[model samples]
Target chain A: MSDAPGVLTHAAVMTGRSLRISRRNLDAMITAMMLPIMLMLIFVYFFGGAIETGTAYDSYVMYVVPGVLLLCAGFGSATTAVAVSEDMKGGIIDRLRSLDVGGAPVLAGHVVASTVRNLVSTTLVFGVALLIGFRPAASLGGWLAVAGVLLAYIVALSWISAAIGLLARTPEAAGGFTFFMSFLPYPSSAFVPVDSMPGWLHGFADHQPITPAIEALRGLLLAQPVGNAPWIALAWAAGILAVAIGLSGVLFRIRTA
Target chain B: MPETMIEAHGLTKSYGKPSDPVRVLDGLGLQVPRGEVFALLGPNGAGKTTTVRILATLTTADSGTARVAGFDVVADRHRVRRAISLTGQFAAVDATQTGEENLRMTARLTGLSRSHAKHRAAELLERFGLTEAARRQVRTYSGGMRRRLDLAAGLVGSPEPGVFFLDEPTTGLDPRSRRELWQVVRDLADGGATVLLTTQYLEEADRLADHIAVLNGGRAVAEGSPETLKARFPGHRLDLVLTGREAYLRLAARAVHHSPGTLTLGLPTDGTAAHARALLDEIDPHRTDVERFSVHSASLDDVFLALTGETAEEAAGETTGETTEPTEEPTHV
Candidate 1:
């Protein structure tokens, strides 16, 4: 009757809806929270002695914790794609559009919910790493810097997942986007040093976006010289965020139109 | 408060590639005056949903003009959206959310304040007979309850009389649920809201709509009041049951339709005792071949058959084979 709510109000309502959905899907939430911790334990205890990081660290937990944090973001953000895709496949998208809700607010809700979920999982992974003798030399400033860089990456990745959700036709197909995001860190330096890989894979490992993000987080967490890594990581995040946002807008129109 | 709540002219829409496009709406045009219930009756793939989608501003027409609530559907879509509510074929409520939560969310999205949204949600739940189940997840609802909630969601924040588009609102509902929804639609129109509903059931149109448009192949093949459309058939039908296949075969050429399975023959009559008697005497003078005969008034089904030259079910089957839309009723429960 009155004019449809403003974009901010719409986004707030939609964010609440997404969060409630995430809460009710307890199995998914638990899996998202537990997978990173499980992987960190496997890497630190099972494979840490056999592998070398080529860096001086007190324990394997210190070396693997940052990579596991990135993994947590990747896994947690994948649900955004599934959630967005479910909205598209269901009748809710048409209902919302008819209510004068635009694509920006709908996608923004998913991205924000995704960021929140990833941050929670990242904190849990960090807590578990600390319990296992992982020690960080970072000061308060270093911890804030790490949070900023990780937040940027999480926001960017969530937008990308949202775009992928719009692009996919079915929820099952959209879920495939998760595998690609979860696997992205593997080719980079998430698990082991890029330098330790064979010569042919170095070009991708050294140049991909994930490497800089991991290097920035690792350097900041250890209080080592960051050397422009944070700036490069932020630049990559901003670039990806911009493109993903644009692509998602276009895809929403195409899918709904 | 325009006299004509909805209007469209020369609307056309197509799907698939440009070189091999499948036309869904071909220059379809319609007009529904304020507070009137207009029914678009058609089989699946008859472009009923396409027309509703275009008017609701959820999809665009390939080439044509449409106005809803006196605003251009494309140029002033935001205003149009504010003035209309669409209950699509599927129930649009969130499966994970409770019925009350879904209503409150829709209320908030429609610009209601937090407290007002909560109050309106409770009011709608009670109105739609969903108060007992308001706290349960919608995924646990039966098909009928979900539909009621879906309709309630559309009514959120709709304080003023507005245009309503219901695309196959009762396609998969049981008879009781269908009747209940029909009453709701009638009440909506009685309360001064403009209602435009699409359905495959002839009885739904006859019972609820002030005017009916029978659609086939993306065009309105016939449009009029239910009585006017039925009058187009112009007479009653005399049904004859033959005692043997031999008699049925003999009269098959003269009858309008002969069903071999039932050994019955349908003959058009002028609805007079004289004409009925004459036909019976001519077919079987001594009544040796004819078992019995009865004259019945024409129905909308007869009008549809006369206008489209095919039964609704047969036409529905043909369209379902060619189009991507689902022909079978979707099982949402």
Candidate 2:
């Protein structure tokens, strides 16, 4: 095994490098920066007038908050997969493979960029929602809890996306995979209430990772009780993280192998 | 005799249909002494790059034993990785980031401290004549500049022992750029780095490599120093540059062989100055005076062509008739 300190330090530095590259690419920044604000505006100005809620219309975005952040994470992660594929297409990955770098750190660089991008996008979306008269009525502790949940989820998904990006045959395949992820945000309760749906749909949604995650975020963002959602969310996040990391390890093996 | 830094014995790779596998390297063996530039020459698809990949620990061999800096490639891969750097056909530097940033990123990955990374990047950029382009995105750089930047990035880590695997590093380059890169390669070798270079250009290998291996059909057709390879050929010829088409054809009819448009006539000779003069006198003075000429002997091209009994391109065709490698199990170098 490699020295633990060395591995962590190298991984952190690689992540920083990826973050800098992501920052310099204006298209990436614009995509992340605009997404949160656009979603907040669309739900608040247009949808707010028409939809009736048992509670305040402004409170609807708080429920939508978890879903929007998931969408944000998916969007950010997909682009990183494309970026890694592009770099690998023409001897770039070959060159990296030749260097004195362990494969893990190289993977770390791309995944970090995805996580950081989603974080920025989530934060921005929440900020915009606040500006548009959306009130959480939640304490700072609650908001922090929601942020922590989002961060954990982001880390898990980013690794899976990075592996996909690295191992895909072509760049177009990488881009096309984004559509699959876009659809994933649908099955989760990111938009409509799960209770409003049919029995089967509600059952499936209730059991899904997105459901517990959204419930927790909704609890924190709207000052409702977290109840069982926090435990469920933690479990879901941990499971997905373990699976994704293992999948990434396998993909990495196939790639270098 | 130089100490050996790399050694591969009876290495081979098989890919394709499980029942009918294609062997890419059939019992290949190689040794590169410490601090020597070794060239692996072959046409496209001759498995030169594949051999380099195996040596760099990027891919595994089916049946063989190999070591880099005395570390087993499969079992002690981290140690192997710590000793080498790779620069592929195109520059590996990130296009979105500035050149300096790319180098610094590599430095950081290789385990330099943050400040040390910055310092190393600056030093390499300057050494590679990229100081002016250091702050610019690599996407905007010219091909030559990008290649230079790529070289700089490879050196950012200052890997111990400096075993570099360069695959066709000078493809599609202008003569001036190619020469400049050659100088860079020479400089690296001079500084005591062990370099493994693969190339299609015969001249580049002859000019740079201390020892050359000519690969054909995934095996070594000829392996020796450039001088030794040339000596093995043991044949010299005189080249007469004719002035007029009619003159060239008339001379060609009497002479051995001639190129169609170039008006150059070849006469097999024993490398004697007198034989060249006799061939010159054989030409009609009115029709053509030698524009300029040289009596040259066998090159790596001639040695490769003669020893392989087939051109490198032919070997590639044969490889295709065999099976492509199957992508099933993970095979680390």
Say which candidate scores most in DockQ. Answer: 1
Query: Compared with the true structure, what per-residue lDDT tens digits does model 2 show for residues B186-258?
Result: 9999998999999986779889999999887688888999888765554565666777777766666654335
Candidate achieving the largest TM-score: 1
lDDT per residue (tens digit) for residues A33-94 in model 1: 89888988899899988878875777677788888998888889889999999999988999
Clash-forming residue pairs, model 2: A257-B331, B15-B325, B16-B326
Q: Residue by residue across A109-207, what tens digits does model 2's lDDT show?
A: 778878878887777777776675667777988877887788888877777777777668788898787668656766766777666668878778778
Worst 10 residues of 2 chain B by lDDT: B324-333
Clashing pairs in 1: none
| Residue B52, model 2, lDDT | 79
**B47-139 in candidate 1: lDDT tens per residue?**
999999999998899999999999999999988988888899988999999999999999999999999899999998998889999999999
Model 2 CA lDDT for position B15:
80
* TM-score (C-alpha, index-matched) for candidate 2: 0.83
Best by lDDT: 1
